[model samples]
Target: MSFKQLLYILLFFFTVSAKGSFILIPMDETTQQNHLKAYGITYWALDKQYKISWLLNYRGGSFLLPDAQEIRKECQIRGVSFEVLSDGESNSILDEISSPSQNMEAVVLERTPKIAVYTPKGKQPWDDAVTLVLTYAEIPFTPVYDEEVLSDGLLLYDWLHLHHEDFTGQYGKFFGAYKNAPWYIEQKKNAEALAAKLGYGKVSESKLA
Candidate 1:
């Protein structure tokens, strides 16, 4: 091939390779289409063994992930807004975030945290906002109640979300208004039964233990 042909070939390859090396998901209120789904995307990346950087205090704490077609497709499917940054551009952003004067840091995130929701089984607590959001985000979390907690099951998970929970065993002080509600009656019955099975005379005592 001629020298001109070789030059053109190299230029084409450089342009293609420099198009995008990083996926930047801005978490600011004005730009992000779906903030929660963006989190889902990060979780998805972590689950796939991708090491991502959380840009703390940068544009409201954005995420930096390696550019991949699969992740672009996921962001499109989940309605999460993102931007593609070339390698030089990505490095510049990181450098700005890493400066001593800037109040920002890029925290590396590699592990997918195992989440546990402390909620009573058969208590119909899944309808709550937190669980609903988690479901919508497609994030998997285990539901655990007093039974699991009493047995040291909490040690198995990395993060715990409280759902209609009361460690004091006072039923969240719902007695004044929900005392006549059938759900309230069932809740009291279940707590008492669980406490008895756990060898405690009162639910409060079981909870304290």
Candidate 2:
């Protein structure tokens, strides 16, 4: 082939490859390698002020992120499965989703939501499941208790997890059963201490506060 023809062919291939400039994080069960880390990565990107599009009902609600080198590195580090798509391919997918016949929508997410877990700060006999999951997923959340709630500290968070909580001020109805248990006694002691700190004479009053 002529030298000029060879140069033109190479440039054509380069242009085609350069068009693939978006990352598609697939959440479908068949393709997703790590479901938990995928969510964490999305949250991480959002926290970094990167705009992400949530593809609702599309390939199990995938996430579309800008094709940044750091994002690719993050996906690899977190073991999250993803695909690279050309601009044309990405637009085609969006168009398909925009069709009324398809049960899908693209939501642009720009804000990082602040999450709070409503639970005691004192050490407990057991760990909260929601907190465990959040920890594993690498998501950060604030731990709030009755004192914080009473003081209107909840206003600082966008989402709140009840975290195996109780109401009616009965302390999970533990008085009749296992009240003498060391863990139960310690738990009650902490509750009373918190109630006192909140200027309540009784735990029930603190709960109601």
Model 2 lDDT vs. the true structure?
A: 0.88
Against the reference, the lDDT scores of all candidates come to 0.90, 0.88
Q: Candidate 1, after superposition: displacement of residue 177 in Å?
A: 0.5
**Candidate 1 weakest lDDT stretch, 10 residues:** 119-128
- For each candidate, give its TM-score against the true structure: 0.88, 0.88
The reply for model 2, stretches above 4 Å from the true place, is 1-19, 123-126, 173-177
Error of 1 at 92 (Å): 1.0
What lDDT score goes with residue 112 in model 2? 87
lDDT of 1 by residue, 8-76 (tens): 999999889756989999999999989999999999999999999999999889999999999999999
Cα lDDT, model 2, residue 91: 98
